[model samples]
Target: MAEKKTPPPNNNRQFAVWGLIILLMLIVFTVAQSGASRPAPGETFTFSDFRERVEASEVQSAKIDIPGGVVTGKLRNGEDYSVNVPPVSADPAGEILDGSGVPYEYAEKTEPSVLANILLSLLPLLIIIGLFFLVFRNMQGGGRGGAMSFGKSKAKLLTENTKRVTFEDVAGVESAKEDLKEVVEFLKDPSKFTRLGARIPTGALLVGPPGTGKTLLARAVAGEAGVPFFTISGSDFVEMFVGVGASRVREMFAEARKHAPCIIFIDEIDAVGRHRGVGTSGGHEEREQTLNQLLVEMDGFEGQEGVIIVAATNRPDVLDKALLRPGRFDRQIEVPYPDIQGREKILEVHMRGKPMAADIDVKYIARGTPGFSGADLANLVNEAALLSARRNKLKITMREFEDARDKVMMGAERRTLAMSDEEKAMTAYHEAGHAIVGLNMEGSLPIHKATIIPRGRALGMVQYLPERDQISQSRQEMIARMAMAMGGRAAEELHFGYDKVTSGASSDIEQVTRIATAMVTEWGLSDEIGPIAYKDTDQQSFHPGIGRGSAISPETAKLIESEIKRFVTEAHDKAREILTDKKDDWIALAEALLEYETLSGDEIKALLDDGTKPKRPDLSGGKRPTVSPVPTTKSSKGPKTIGGPSEA
Candidate 1:
């Protein structure tokens, strides 16, 4: 069992601050007391009273304390008396004292603040007692509220809200739930498992993308198991001070073991579990120590049996391998994006209390959003509800859902964006080119919609989706998609001259280049490259874009670029050919898009099917055989005034 940590040693800086505060207080108190001890100016006796005493010869020899500005004397009875008087008196008091045969002497008052030293000596004892009380109170709570107890674990032992989550509250992560359900049974009846010579698995790791509810799944296990749950972030285990984080890891594990059969969840565990020897030169030493202690606590000798460690991280690749071994986190469960049915279930769960219209079909919404995670589906439902409320509607309708889906996927429509006629016409033609090519291409995904309305950073967009959920793409299908990416640029070069083409196709060119490059370098799809592929990244590079040298030589690198450029040029020519053959169909779609800013898949397919013929692409030349493309030609589809040689 781990022992509780004492209060951390106070640093010299803390002592300095305390000393300054005490000195300030002493100065203020001493000044206040000294001011209080001085005699007030109004306490002086009248000069007439002084003369009466003098005439009766009751006054003895008098001496003046100049700094105190008071007269000290003894009367006939040898008693002392003092009176407040001006240090420089007028002639009346002086002459009266001189004529009465009283001898007066002037002397300076020597001492100041004598009593302050005595009070100061006694004050430290009281302050010291108060300091001890404050330190004791803080250490009791693990110094969490102050900088002093940084070594104490920052994990929150949640007891108030564990019952709020169970398996029913979690949606769309069925496989991960299945992986964790056995742990609950083991926690409830460990003897049953041990009888069969099987020890309860020590730990389980939840690995997934962000927003996939890894932490929520852990909470559900706690809720179902009826055991204590401790939650802490990975970053909470790290502090600037050395050894503090390691102390915290030991303390956290010890605490969890006390409540047998409990769960300790570390969220985003990658922060302190990065690959060793890769971070800051010496600054990351603290994190490495924390990770080391965590490793020992999870798998070391006398490792607690009933305390199960559960950790969650989106970045499992960066986590220390030692932490992922058998005894530490035996079960590595993956939580991925929801499937179509799973998405529907997630939507149903999120839409429980929403005031939806009677005719709303949740299956349709789920089918439309193919790759949405559970969290994204929830946000979509919320966005739809808010949109309905904004329109002052009593319930959410299908129109609002569609609008919200569009807003979530492709940004909200920028209705107020200003554009000239020329720019709008250019954008319309650009989007129409994509719709035409996508509709005519073989094995192309169905066109979902086309819009010339400005949205996000785009002037126009044509969106498409696979007929069914797809796991992977074939080489031929990727080439077709690359052709689609080039359609916008090809349209510009066809309608406008090569020299007159605008930079509107910048994004399209980038898309085309990226797809073509991947085909050669990563997907191993190029016939000439012959099943060879370069790594997408280097493991040892410190920065994202910087590299020491290529996996291939400089010459081979040039060859890769040439191949990518050739493939992109061929795709552009293919797009031009398809658009040229279906010029009227493309023109009709563009006119429709200009008139109505948004068009659905069915609407787009209807316009293309009015009188269009199917055309097939020539896939005979694998990698194009390094052939030079043909020269330009005059197409009736192209504008006559903007004629120029076609770009190869």
Candidate 2:
């Protein structure tokens, strides 16, 4: 093992060293002054003799003369001095006073000379202390914080008791939680495994998108371990200096060693462990050095004993392989978007302290939020509670939950904007078309709610909540979904004629196009194209390069386009047939939507059952049935449901 380099002294140590140096200087001055000031052995001389001695030297001319004494002029070699001569009678040696006696007892002190001597004596120490402070401050990274404390690592210490969150606190992610169970056991009772000569893994890497509970899992491990946890960001190890990042890495490991059987979590490790030489730059020395040191600490000659290093990163593909070898990051756990059950559990966890109305259902909310993470669910609950509070409601209602989900998914509502009656009817029909198609189509995803209320940049939206998380899709299911996506525009064309077709289906069109293109070019589902996937030059952005089997001719492209259009046309015709047969049902749903503006799946299914033959409360007048307008484009007004079926 290489000897770790000692970091430079911190401020407290620097101040202590300076204090000791000053104390030593004062002691030396005291000692020298005490010894040198001892009285000379009975030596006395009259001022007259002093003047003669001064006159004989080269420095005598600079001396000043005073009253009752003979003194020379200003001296050349030394600074000017005024020396007062004692009376000649006071001199026991009786040396006759010279005619020009020098007054050597009194002289003005030179200010410049005193200052120069003091500076000369202290200059080197000041320079050294200043330079030391400069390096330390630079290493520390200044920003009005304690920038001079370079040797102190910037890691947050979390002990089991200090962290209020245990594994039980992190709801959802059952599989991930199960995967971490062994880790918890390893941390809690290392001797159980090590007694059989089993070595514990040095690290585990959590890979997932943000807000997927990566950090929460790490905390759970620490809480389960019941040991010290050191938490820090990957950027905390970096510094502008060449070796500061490496220095921080060394210090962090040293700290972890102090508390053995500990867990150290570094969030977003890709900041320091990016793949080397993949980009234009050869490699960044700071990050490289930090990662290198981290590698060494993980499995160097002196391997990390009883220390587990866990890290989380969203982009694990860009990390260096050396840092992810077997001894290090031994297990890679993925925390993906929550499934339906997981989402329900997560919602329950987040809804703990809130007062919910009886109508509020966790399962419904879970179904509505198809792609929400645990954190997102928590945020949704909190946002709903906030909305309830804002409305001065005593408890959270289902309306608030719905509004919160919409706000989170599609941004805030734009209620103040005004729309023409025609536009409102068009948007209503557009969204109604989507809801009807999604409900009627086989293998279509379940509809959560449909609304014509403008939100975000959309004039209207139809939200379909998946029953569960699906990792794989069948070709039939994909086609059915694409057709459903295109159903809004197709419905507009069939019912309202071409005049009412709006660009409200832009997103839907894009989705359908990509699905159709992929089916023909990548999925090899086209019969004319055979089993070979056609190489799409446009694949650089959307499709992978290797999926293409051959270059497609123009004829094949034309055939693919026709096949796609035929598929869409058949789906559209099927929807029209279903609607035409159930015109009364469609009108009932449209009227209910116009009244409430939204409805859950249960409400819609109930409507579908009784909608076809709604009984009238009044039948006293014997009359032929009145045929209502089909709510098509030619009908400038909204559809009316008089609770009766009309002939098609």
Candidate 3:
């Protein structure tokens, strides 16, 4: 179908407002200029001087304005003159003029036209009315509300020719797509389902984390079904006025019914669908009212056979129970972050129109990003293209992708950050400790890179790359991770005296504490706290006072805290032991980072294996060395200590 483009609303009303103001200003300016055009009396005289001049036969043809209490005339010498008449004796001025034998008559009193009087009286009221009309017209143009149409639905209609999206445009959530495909199929041909006694679902709720393509999926369903789509936000239905939201809900459903087999998509329904009476101040009456109307419209008394409602929200746990019942939202589809294969598909979709190098491996990029959503992958591709453009490259390559991923994950590198020799050395040693521990510790993830370049909040970083996405971590792996996290602090205390250690290990200490606490309390790793999950007191409760207190008794709480401290202490000691044994290798890696500022996994591995530094590869030519798959091993060094500890 040919797309019809509607012209935008003209701002003629705004121009009219300006024109009215200009006209009023022009009228005032013309009246002031006309008043200034009248001749000024050349000379002023007191009442006595006027009377003397008149009696001396000096006044000639004097004219008196009785209402204004002033007289003007030409003197005998032809000079213009004027005199004031006393308010108490207006008749005296006329008598004096008569006695002077001057040919003078009272100035004729002029009355204004009746039409002018009416127009002057009505001008302000007309300006006020025009202003109100213009303001209301502007409000109506927003399409959300107006002075009189406050209860109208703000849903935007999307036709086939407008913002069309099909299933082919979406990737990475095949299950969600499959579920919605049934809805589309029913809309396409209702007879297929009606004959089999299977009634189509009234609504489906897309539940997921943010940026998982929930809204896009809804649009795709409408496109595939070739039906009209009405898109609105849950917040649009709410207003400060009572009963306004209910009215809007009724109007929206009524409109949807007119176009049968249409889809109505509400984004972020949690904004209005929150559990009633759970707020700090009882509950939001406006939002609760909106949700009530929506619930009724979904499975109301009136038969809405063909209209389908699809809403997206990340916060399904907080939604009202009535909204998720069987009849209202028949399907609750989960749109989670893409797995490895799904991520590759998402990457491919985002990379369609971009110029990519021959060596750009989509699978490799996907593998590196474990918990990335579809939107994240799209951003990654765009960032890579931007990086390539910055370098004046024709196509995005693996190097640009790698740089973009690092920039996204860690943050852009801070090349201009200056550090003193002492600080730089400490940062080098700190990151070196992390790399060495992560590489040699049993069950730890493989170290991808170690760099002393400042990025984000970290002065240096040693990043680990998982071979695959991990669903669960064993106790041994958790212990290894804790030990690795403590390595930086251990190295700092072992090299510099305990008093000289910097706060650079704060993040490492935090990570170690979190891992140890989770292991003991949540994961039930400690035998003393066996197989029990203790609820965290910090968790928020819907009720005012309930669930706010600690679930565990004081004795159990102290025991848990002691166990957490024990786990961290053991991990720290183990890291110190390993660093003491591998002092030479650790020193060599730290010195290498200081010289080169960055080292890849292979370079770090080779440098640790021997004392020799490997030659850096040139990445500017857009060709990168092939990456070998990491061996799936617990540890490669056979648990051997590298060197003897130096004498204190």
Candidate 4:
């Protein structure tokens, strides 16, 4: 276990220094002012002495005199030690000064009003000093409550023992893992490489989609190297004030240097490293200046070995090219979604502590979740555990796992929602269209489940499981997939006509649109845009510019649009025809949905084969028999409403 940290105690010596300085200054000022205000040693008597003598002459008073403007008085022999000055003649009992240091002329004290004078003299200086201390405290990280820590980087620090995330902890992206392993070794044993005149690369960049384990890989690198790790988000380097961002970058790098052989991981570095000269969107001077400083530090000539910079970004396209240069980034590791085996391994790692039933098939779950990333898998297990807890079960069963997977992929279950009879019928037809079309496709995933149940925001959903994980998708496979996505809307148009088409198929429409767009603009599947990608490289410029190797004018744009339209139209036609031919199967599937409000993959397959799902002979207990088709897209209809571009 990692040790807990405690704050350092206050310094008594520093406190003493300031306290003594304040005391000495006060004493010096008092002594100097006292000397300046006092009377000299000796001088002749003046008019002041005559006034005192005259005042003393009137009888009971003692002798009095003044010299150098200072008054003196003595008591008469008849008196003890007191002396008195006579009052004015007409008012003999009027106020007067006695020789015991009382005022003679007025009620208030005259010359030697020492204490008040000293305080009066110190008042201005004290006010100035008070204001100075206030300003001092403000500048010295005091008086703003916790505001002073605002500029500090909020990056978390992790070491080998605290992190415990080695390469073994991260699954999938085996190639990327292998590359990062070398980076860890380089950090640990730099001297060995240096003896052979080889310097370790200063930085590595991980570029991939979100939830692909980029940050996790960084932690693993730290653990494998067994060194101090400083982790910060790219946004942490930016601030409202100009130059503050750059200053922070400098500070971060400087702090990392103290550890020498350590990793500094900046997640989402594109926050600061956007292409410069793109105007406002490149971000303000703060971000730009920070990027400049980061560039300098990463590839600076005063190169330090064993100090590595690791950064992760999902959008590498927007990043500045200068930052990605050889000397700066040095290596670019792509962390993509896992393959079949990789997903199984990832699921296994996350399932370590979960109480899963023996019947839970990792492969089945992995196949159903085609595009899931490592993070998504982790979330799946967590969601399943919660579902199990909610049901008050001893352990998580396969059903709970299925619900958890759907909940994570889709939104939460919308149980309170009630669908109208018309809406339910339309959803059933829509999902059944997809299932039937998918079944007819030559090489598509097998249907896992088809249901019109309102889980998530969708009125209906279909899940298809690939017979096995596919590492690469063929062009035919992509087209077949797009056709299945269009089936929902196609069925609505077929049954209710175009006028009755509902927004229920909006998601399906969006998926098809993207696929169609990618085909023409990205993949060059259209002959009109043949073998060329028209994707705007310079997103900095708003207007679309000319493309290379082609003279595509207004007519070409129309042609491209026509190709996309034709592609969707053909897919829709194919779905309508398939569903029409499989009308009996479609009705049977819909009836099953109406009865149960849901259907598992096997149950649906059983419905297609016979009129009902058969019981599982192997499994015991009174549970309803859930069918399982020997997974094949050709022989079986895939799940109902699931269609998307596969992550693999």
Per TM-score, the best of the predicted structures is 3
lDDT for position 581 in model 4: 84
lDDT of 1 by residue, 523-640 (tens): 7777766567664465421121332366567666766777777889988888999999999988788767666666777877766677332232323222212111322332222211
For residues 6-43, write the lDDT of model 2, one tens digit per residue.
35434665566568668656655654553342222222
> In lDDT terms, which candidate is top?
3
Of the two candidates 2 and 4, the one with more favorable TM-score, higher being better, is 4
314: Cα error in model 3, Å: 0.8
Per-residue error for 219 in candidate 1, Å, reads 0.8
lDDT of each: 0.73, 0.67, 0.78, 0.69
Report the C-alpha lDDT of model 4 over 400-454, residue by residue, as the tens digit: 8888877876566675775445666676777887887888887666777776767
Which sections of candidate 4 miss by over 4 Å? Answer: 1-156, 161-163, 278-283, 469-472, 497-499, 527-551, 613-643, 646-648
Better of 2 and 3 by lDDT: 3
TM-score of 4: 0.73
For residues 359-437, what per-residue lDDT tens digits would candidate 3 score against the true structure? 9998889888888888889999999999999999999999999999888877788888755556666767777887777
